[model samples]
Every structure is written in structure tokens, then in C-alpha cells.
Target: MAVNLDKPQRWKEDVARSVDMYNQWFLNFAPGAFRATRISATVSVEASLLATSYLRDIRPETMKKNPSILSMLRMATCPPIAVDRLIGLAGVNSSLVKAMEKDNRLPVRVTGDLLDKELQKIGEIIERMADPDIFVWLARGDEPRQEEIHRAATIVADRLCGAQANPIIRNEQEKRQLAKIKTWLEARGYNEAETKARVDFQNMEPGTFSFRLNVKVRDNTVNIPVDAVIMPITANKGDLPVLIEAKSAGDFTNTNKRRKEEATKMAQLKQSYGDNVNFVLFLCGYFDSGYLGYEAAEGIDWIWEHRIDDMAELGL
Candidate 1:
């Protein structure tokens, strides 16, 4: 990648565009996160509009993907005093709706008994907002202005990133989804039958490498192909070429018995193919599933692991 000195500015521009698009498409999604906010109860028509504008400027996808912002704030170790103060401000109940509006304060709606219960919860969140870690107001702040629900999502995403410090690997069903990736590749002129196709490249230098993948589809009269091979021809004719088994994350294991079993399988493949089987191994995985392994052969480091992430990202 070429070094770009003004990357920060460029990144901000992309984030801004993402946020704007998110607000326009999903702001009024009923029964969603937006419904659970103060703006829904008070009907601060103007405030909601301003809040939407503010939120459209910041990336809301981050928040939408993360856990609740309130939960993240509590985990951040915010002080007690800060929490209490915010709660007190939020606890205001049965305020004169018109008076509160005239004074530019949050307008409270009249809902009789249920009003007290909701106010209590809102008060607590407000108290937490008092922390000098002002962002704790979460997708809040901007007094008297109805905060856009989209802003809430971004705040939650920020809190999750800043507080969790965990990868929280998503797409747990990656093993199942990998099939789509293969199907997508085939549409792009990637023929699985051609993976086993080899072209003689004599006089190639040591440490040279080539890859092949053969996929089988179900047919009444045909066999299903479920194998891939990556060949790394060694320079020393006397030295045995190393073969690697490329399986998906869950398929690959580090047990001693499994390693020995794989070794035996490779020995059989070598014997069956002879000189043609310079390097033979099972490459069983989707493009993005990270289960590739590595080994050194004759001082040459060979990555036997099949990588799917980069290939999938490229839509190959």
C-alpha cells in the first residue's frame, strides 16, 4: 500500500457517508432501538430532526453491531458520582410540557402511572451521563434536541470497541457459509476441475509454488470432487517435497494422532502418484476460513495453509 499522509481525513469522509446512508434508510424502523428512546415518548418533533442530522454525520453501523451502550459504560469503570448526577437529571417527572419546552429542557409526556416507571429508568441513564467521560451520555447529550436513534447505535459501537478489547469473532456459522463463497467463485470463471490441472514447469527455481483446487458437484453418474492440492516443488531433487493438508478452522486439529494419520495419508498419496506427486495434500476449506498451516522444507519456508480470507475479500 502506498503511504498516504492524510489517511485520517479520508477515513472520516467514508464514515460520514456510511452514517448518512444509515440514517436515511433505517431511522424510523418501528419496534426497533429508536422506539426505546426518550424522543419517542416526548414527541420532540424539532429535536428529533436535529438529532437525525447529527447522527447522519457519524457512522451508526458501529453502534448497531455492538452491544448496548449502557452496558459498555458500566464496564468502562465510570465513577459513582458521575453516574448519580446523570440519573438525577433524567429522573425529572411530570414536568410542565410547555414550560419545559420554553426553557429548552427535555419535554416530559403525561402518561399517568406508567410515566413514573419509565422516568425512573431514564433518570438512571442520565445519572451515568454525568461522568467526565462525557461520551457516556452515549447516543445522547444535545439537551432539548431529540437524539437520532441512529446516533445511539454508533455510540454503542464505540463503547464496545473502546471497552471490550475482544475480537468477538462474528459469523459463527462460517463453516456453513463457506459454500456460498465457492459458488460465487465458480460464477467468476474459477473452474474447480482445473485445480488438479498441472502444467510442466521444468527448470523452475527451488521454493517455487503452485496451487490447485478441485470441487465436485452432485450428479447421478459423476463422483463428487472434494479436494484441493498446493504443490511447492523443491530445488533439491534428492529432498522430498513437503505436502500440507489445508482444512477449515474446525477441521484442522493439533493432536499428535491426527498429525501421524495425515502423514500416513500423504505417504500413500506419494506412493500412488510417484514422481507426479511431488507435493500432494488435501486443501479442504473456503477461501476465508483461516486454517492454513506452514512447514519448512530444505530451509525453504512453505505455507501449506490454505487461506480463504483474502480470496473471499477479493470476491474471487
Candidate 2:
């Protein structure tokens, strides 16, 4: 019932087509998306540099008042270091710095005293590692030149861009994919789920679809956040809703690296519920034949974004 999956020759053609489509989309939209993200990132980085006194005052007290500055501190360095590198240089707990960079605060386990001590160590590390030329305006006792500030912020913003998972593009792709799915499902009389809580999969009403639904395992201890779930008009209370993962990739490398995640999720689903639980991938972007082969071997099936009508194969 799956399209192009049973025939290797046909699947290869589909992969080429999908890759071409993704490339075209990227060529058209990715630059604008990156520019928008970079502009916002540059503004934030500029503000951070200003707040840090142009990297002259990374004192413990300053850091204590604003742990979020730690990220800026790392970026302000000559060759901007990663979070882990900063932690290593400071000889502090990795979680402390990682928490600060990620959540802009220390973890709950870090007490006030511990936070002060950690901040002192981190501040000393940044002070030692701060780029002298970048902070040269401090020695002159004058405001940094506009161009100098802009250059510093741009470098930091560029580094931040590389370090991220490219969230902006991914979010846009998800929005578009979800919107398409919504239109397709609605045409078939599927209604959106009213509540945002964990979906009662077993008792899902007929012809219902939900976005970002939480489905718990048999023990109810862990919940899996599904991208979309749908119940067909023919389904009864005992039937499980159809689970779909909306996936996109910018490159082949990441898809291959992350291919195991889908297999793991599928294993968890079948282990918790039953083999009959339907799980599918709604894929776009740079998934290649190797990635497809891996997913297929794991008993997982996918519907290409180029061929979304293939969702009917799952009886949606």
C-alpha cells in the first residue's frame, strides 16, 4: 500500500525528486529566512555586548545579576568558544554553564552559594580569554565605534547561527507542512481536537485530527509528543489514532544521523501499545535512499511531502 517503497528503482527516482524540490525551496526562501533571523540575532548580541561594558566588566556580581550574559561572554571572546569549552576553561560544572547558556539561569539544584562561586570562576575565565582588540575601546575610555560594535555583533551572530539547529527554517517548514495536512484532512471531514491535553487515543472520536498531541505509554509515566494524529471516520473507540511525524531536513548528513530516532520512537510505540499501532512519517527535504532504507528496515513507512496524497495509504 505504501508508495515507491516496494520498488527500489521507483524509490530512487522519488528520492531524487524530493531532493530537487527541497533544493528549489531552499534556493528561494532560505536566504530571506536566514537574513531575518540574523538581523534579530545581531540586535540581541549588540545589546549583550553593551550590557557587558564591551567585555571589560565580566565580574562575578555582574554575572550573578545576569547569568544570561554568559552566552554573550562566550560570543565576545576572540574566537567565540562553545558552551562546553567555556565550562572546561572555567573548570566549573558543565551543567551550570550549559543551563545558563540554554535556559539563561542555573539549574534548580545549584544553590545561591554555589551559583556565586560558579559565576566567579566563569567570570575569571572570560576575563582571561576576552579578546583585547575587541575590547580596545575600554582602554581608550570612549564608546566603541559603531562599525566596531557592528562587526563584533555580526561575528557573534554568525557563530550563533552555525551553533543552532537552524530553528527558523525548521519552524517555517513545520508550519507549511502542518497547514497542508490540515487542508487535506479537513477535505475528508476530519475535525481538529478541542483539547491540548494528552489525547485519549483509544477513545478518539471518528474523523478527528490533532496537532502536537501528547500520547502516553501504557504506564502513563512518559508522553510522546506526536506532530499530528488523525482518526478515520471508520474508526471505533478501541481503535488507535493514526500517528504522523512531520519531518524536514536541510541536508542528507543530518537525516542519516537522526534516522535512528524514528526507529526508536517506533519501537517505543509498538512496545507500549501493540504492533497494530499505526505510525508514519510525513517527510520533506533531504532524506536519501539510505535513510529511507533504514526506516523501512525498522518497519516504519513514510509519505513524501511531494506526494502527500499518499496519506490515503494509511487509510486516513
Candidate 3:
């Protein structure tokens, strides 16, 4: 009952359509999403700059009193640097900077005494390395220009948010796909599971679905997260739930590169739950013949976003 997977010859046509659909969606919505996020980020960066007095007072006491500003410290510099790069430049403890960047706060173990020393080193590096042209207001001996502050914040916002814009789009796309699945399943009398943890498939009422369920695999020690779990309407006691992974890719190269991850998950499921385990993919975006062929060879199948109704073939 497989669609494009069973009919290998039709792969080229399906792939073309899938890619076109993804491109059209991106062209229509991606720019607006990016701009909205950047606008929000700009507001945040401007607030951080104003709090720091335009990077003129990055003293340990100031940073300690306002720990949240540490996240934006590098961005406020003349030329922003990433956390790892700042660590390399400042020659500070890698763990400290890594923790700061990851959690957006100073680690609790870093005492006030240590903070002074660390901030001194980091501040000196920024002062020495930051571009003189960008920080000219510091030497001008007058109030920082409002336009300059806005321009600097905008640049920082672009750096901070632009890198994550594609990922934001991908998350939004996944949410949309899941919403569609919810609507269709609900229409068919499928109830949504309320539990946040993994559910016992046998106990789940027939015709129920859950999002982001975790399944124990690989000898029941490792947990594999699936996008959706569905109990077929005709399910009986002890029947395993169907597992669906929602996948999207902007290009063929990344899909081919990450194709093995799905195969690994499939192998783990089969090993733990036996060959009867129902694991599948809900795919959108650019997956080419090469990617599809590999998945098919591994006995993995997919339901395209364009053909969501084919989920019926899986007893959804």
C-alpha cells in the first residue's frame, strides 16, 4: 500500500512536487517570520545596550548586579564574537563561558571574588579587541547618539537572531504539520492523549493519538522521541502504538547526510519491540530520490505532507 516508496519510478515526480511545495512555502512565509523575530531581538538588544551604558561600564559589579546582561555582552562589543570565540580571546575558563552561553547566566559556583577576576579579563579583551570605529562615542565625551545606538543594536540583533531564523522556520513547519494531523485524527474520533510522558500503548484507548512520546528502545535503556503516537481504531489489548517522525529539510544534502539517523532509530525499534513495531516518517520539504531510496531500502516508509491522507494505509 506504499505510495511513492512502492513505486520507485514515480519518485522523480513526487520529489519534484515536494521540493516545489517547500520552496513555495519558504518564499511566501520565511521572510516575514525572520523579520518578526529580528524585530523582537532588536528590542532585546537595545535594552541590553541601554542597561550597560552603551558598553562603557562592564565592571564586575555591574555585571554581577545584572547577570542577565551577560548574554548580550559580546553583542554589545564593536564586533560581536560567539561564546567560544570570546573564551579563546579572553583566555578565560572554557567551562564558565560555555555555561554562560548555554544557560544565559553565570554559574552558581562562580563566587563574587572569582567574578571580579573573570570579568576583568573578559572586559580587557573586549576593550582591546573591539573595533575603535564602532565605539567612537566612548571617546567623543558626549551622550551616545540615539541613531547610533539603534544601528548597533540592529546589527547585534541580526547576528543573534539571523543564525537561528531557519531553525525557527523549521519548528513552525513541524507545528503546522502536527496541527494538520491533529485535525484529521480528531475528525476520525481520535482523542488526544493528555500525559506528557510516554504512554502505555496497551492502556491507550483505541483511536487515540499523542505528541512527542518517548519510547524505550535498544534494550529498553535508551529513549527515542517520536513526533506522534497513534493507537489504531481497531487496536486490541497489547497492540503496539504506531510511531511517526515528522521530518523537514531545506536541501537534499542534509537529508542524505541525516538519513542514517532514521535507519538507526528503525533498527533500535525493531530490536526492542520486535519486527512488528510500526515506525514511520511524516515527511515534508526537499527529500530527493537518493534519500527516499535509502529509507525504502531500510524498510522505512514515509507519508508526505502533500499526501497526508495516505496515513490511512498505516491504520491511523
Candidate 4:
């Protein structure tokens, strides 16, 4: 469940609370990056873009007066994972309405065109991740946490899913529009392809890789439908690159647990694929709010969590 820190007063309190949790939990030099993240997480472009100045001492807005290098890690927007979650609701009730109407597809309130301008708006926002200007604002912090980036994505998703902005349509033209816009905007998970999966274990991507590992055993069954993981990064041998499962903002500091759990799977993976397959888990969230209670699994060597609230932090 997402925390309700939509208001300014509540946002400050949330950031302060998160800072305390991290400073105490890690017991290391956390720096003020987390606080900066907290501040960014609460900012809304709708409000921030127009507001000439913010209240003094406000958590995120206060940076305007006493900005520091650490605060640059903050994300100016929400993460992509969260935005996808929000899109889950696109065109919701269409099926039920179609059934009631005894028709296969439901007609749209905004007819004429196959796609709605509002629906395309979401695709546009998702595209902004690759937009040089937008991403620079999001990844402003130093070493911005992946979890924090995911939080920003989630917020963006929620905004898109909101009734005021988001609407669902099943028209082919609309779907095509979404796909084109999503691809252009660099929307998170847009890299994922949906298809009827086959059950096989030949290491083929299109087929579902069944059988359980030590890490995700309980959650997965012996024979489960799996989606092909599109390569998010280009790789060459000896480049020190390995795949990591990414997470969104929501008690992500539990990455400690994620790391430990991934360790179990990593060992099994190594046994099958050789130690050449290094193990790591990516917690995709904003770093500022701290890993939303997520922790890297115990004994995990390297974990690379990435939050794409903007491209600046990635130095892109």
C-alpha cells in the first residue's frame, strides 16, 4: 500500500521519519541524500512548477534556499514501475460493460477517434524518462536510491490511473498509440512484451522457465507461466554485468531481505549457469525515502538497485 503523503505538512513529517529510520538502521554515513529524496518524493510538478516559493523550512522545498550537493540525488518525478501499476486500471469496466451489453467491446465516452488524448498523455509522460530535460530533474541527488526512483514512478502511475487523468480503451488504434507513445517516452516496463508463453526449460526466452529456485520457491509453483525478461542492458563477456530483479518504492529498505533471498537463488543459478553469473537484485525506487524497508539479502555480494525518476542521476 502507498503512503498518503500528498500534503506538504504530511510530506515533511514523512521525510523526517524516513531519515531517522535510515540513519539508525544503516548506522553509517547515510549523508543527507535520503532527506533530499524524501523532499523530492513529495513534490508535485503541478504544484511545484507554478509555486513561486514554498513555505520556509519545508522538507523538499527548503532546498531552494540552502541547496547542497547531496540533495541533487532527488527525483523530480515518480518512477516507471509505479506508473505501470497505475496503468493496470486502463479501460477497467469495459469487459463487464460489454458483457452486460451483450457486445464484445464497449464503446467509448470519447468516441470518433480510436485513441483518447488523455490516454496518450500517459504515454507521453512515460516517454519523458528518456527526455533529457525531465530525467535530469528526477535524478538530481547523489547516489539516488533505486527505491526512491521507483517511488517517483509509482506516483506518476497513480496520477495517470486517477479518474481525472486516466481512461481505458481497447481499440486497436488506441493500443497502437499507447505502444508507440510508450516506446518513444521510455516508459518503464514498456520494454516488456506480452505473449502466450510456452512451458520449457531449454533456456529459451519465449518459453516459460518452470521449476523453482531456493529464493522464489514459495511464491512460484513447479510449473508456472513466466514472461520473457527483455534485456534492459547490453552485455559482453567479462563486463561485470548480471541480471537483478527490480522493485518499486514501498518499504524498500527491506532490500536486505531481497539480497538474502536472492543469495539463495544466486547459488542455485550459479550451480546451473556457473559462477560467471554474478548475483544481484535491483530495488527500483527513489533513494530519498530510503529503501522502503527493503534490504539486500544476506550474503549477497553485489546488488544494483536503479530508480529511473529522471536520467540526470544516471549521468545520461
Clashes of each: 16, 0, 0, 56
Off by over 4 Å in 1: 1-119, 125-129, 133-157, 163-169, 172-180, 183-316
- TM per candidate: 0.23, 0.88, 0.87, 0.26
What C-alpha lDDT does candidate 2 achieve relative to the native structure? 0.82
lDDT of 4 by residue, 1-316 (tens): 1112122344334445544543353334222333333344345432332231211112322222222211121222234223233245333223322332233232345332332333333334333433233334333534324454445444433343332221121122223323432343244332333344442233323211111212222324422221112222333333332233432223335443444454566565555556555343322222332232223222233221211232212111
How close to the true structure is residue 230 of candidate 4, measured as C-alpha lDDT?
26
lDDT of 1: 0.32
lDDT of 1 by residue, 1-316 (tens): 1111123344334334433433332334312433333233223322332333322221222222221322333322244223344345445443522222234333345454554454345434534443334333334454322243345434443443333221221122222233434453455444332435452233223333223322212222322122332222223554433333333222224332244444444444444444443332322222111111221111111111222333322112
lDDT score for residue 66 of model 4: 28
Q: Rank order by TM-score, top first?
A: 2, 3, 4, 1
Model with the higher TM-score, candidate 3 or 4: 3
Whole-model Cα lDDT of every candidate shown, in order: 0.32, 0.82, 0.80, 0.32
Which parts of model 3 are misplaced by more than 4 Å?
A: 1-4, 59-71, 105-112, 131-136, 195-202
Off by over 4 Å in 4: 1-194, 199-228, 231-242, 286-316
- 10 residues in a row with least lDDT, candidate 4: 164-173
Model 2 Cα lDDT, one tens digit per residue, 113-171: 78778888887777777776776676687888989889878877877766663787888
For model 3 the TM-score comes to 0.87
Ranking by lDDT: 2, 3, 1, 4
